[model samples]
Target: MDTASRTAIVTGGSRGIGRAVAVRLAAAGQDVAVVYSSNAKEADAAVGEIEAAGARGIALQADVADEDTIAGAFDTVEQRLGPIDVVVNAAGIMALQPIRELDLAQLDRQLRTNVRGTFVTAKEAARRIRPGGAFVAFSTSVTRLHLPAYGAYAATKGAVEALIPILAKEMGDRDVTVNAVAPGPTATELFFEGKSQQVIDRIAGLSPMNRLGTPEDVAELVAFLAGPGRWINGQIVFANGGAA
Candidate 1:
């Protein structure tokens, strides 16, 4: 293996935005490991796409919120691929309900998978990523949109956004950049679930482009940060087509 070859691990990479980012990094000549919570079949498909992109690929199963599990997965990735160059914490869960109507359990699920997951993944990335590498976390435009019924979900990502700059400053000495990508109204399986066409259309129209963001659209920004956008650390970048 070429020691200089970049390697990336993308959580929630079995499908949706995470899958897109993994494939995008592979296309940019980086070996990739797609870490998924479950769904071996989807994970394998993502790896196949990564391989087809002319780069090495593998799939690992691990919970993003579990520190030991993710740490072990990172070890396996380095053993199989190389020292990590990038870690994208694309794994998260969202539940939208008015604050009054929101279930406490739903909020806990979001916090566990979104906040704790990012922290765990980011922790490993901080320690394991090579100098000049990058750590990217996912946020949402809802933080700025302040949409009704998104209180809990938005709050979780807000916490993620708050941590990005602090983590970036902490990693400054190591020459590793840390940032978060805040996508708006992305058209993914998660976004479509429980949303009616009317709701979807209204949200899509919020963008100046009058369309929902595609997973690849957000992946493009992630790919940039993962590779050449080194100066862009410590920011909650909104990739929402002028939305909010």
Candidate 2:
């Protein structure tokens, strides 16, 4: 892939880190395709942001968990934007629950979206992304924090993190770097949902910075991995503010 005309596909680009990544990549000179599952309004707005950054942007709807739909979305993107150089699978869901009180249905949903969705997207990226491209998947810092009520969500992301190294090695011959970004508590709508201010403060205090991460914070790291951080592959990068 030529650096001058690289194109990127970002799943879950309707909001949060994924949206920030799409805008950032666009600002960095990549034509970006925002793959959204629902909410066409938000997806269209994201494309507006991308265009404002002076790059071509398109919105495509596809469930990341469905292989056929996602594969078609990939084909559409390449057909419209030329070959893809970056694939970011940031589409996911979270439902906090203790193991003893786990809801099987919720667990299944998370597994389908977080685990299977990533696999489907990664498979497409492996097949289509050009040489010197990148594939970034999302994990969570909760997998290491081992927090209560995050068992199911963390488990799904753990499975995602497990795919990074092996996939990177497999893509080595193609010169496509594969990695996962594990973000700490972030100040997105998703993170704030169902959480009280007091609880949010305590979680923020866990980081040395004493604040939750912004979508842009994680986006910056992802942009690096997708762009010039090619040497750093097959690893789970923790994008927390010294929250260990």
Cα RMSD (angstroms) for every candidate in the order listed: 1.8, 1.1
Residue 85's lDDT in candidate 2: 93
Off by over 4 Å in 2: 1-3
Instruction: Please provide, for model 1 over 1-244, each residue's C-alpha lDDT reduced to its tens digit, 9 standing for 90 to 100.
Output: 2223899999999999999999999999999999999799999999999999999999999999999999999999999998999999999988889999999999999999999999999999999999989999999998998999999999999999999999999999999999999999998999999999999999999988999999999999999998899899899999999886
Error of 2 at 69 (Å): 0.4
What's model 2's overall lDDT? Answer: 0.94
Model 2 residue 204 lDDT score:
96
Best by lDDT: 2
- List, residue by residue over 2-54, the lDDT tens digit for candidate 2: 34589999999999999999999998899999999889999999999999999
lDDT of 1 at 170: 97
TM-score of 2: 0.98
| Colliding residue pairs in candidate 1 | none
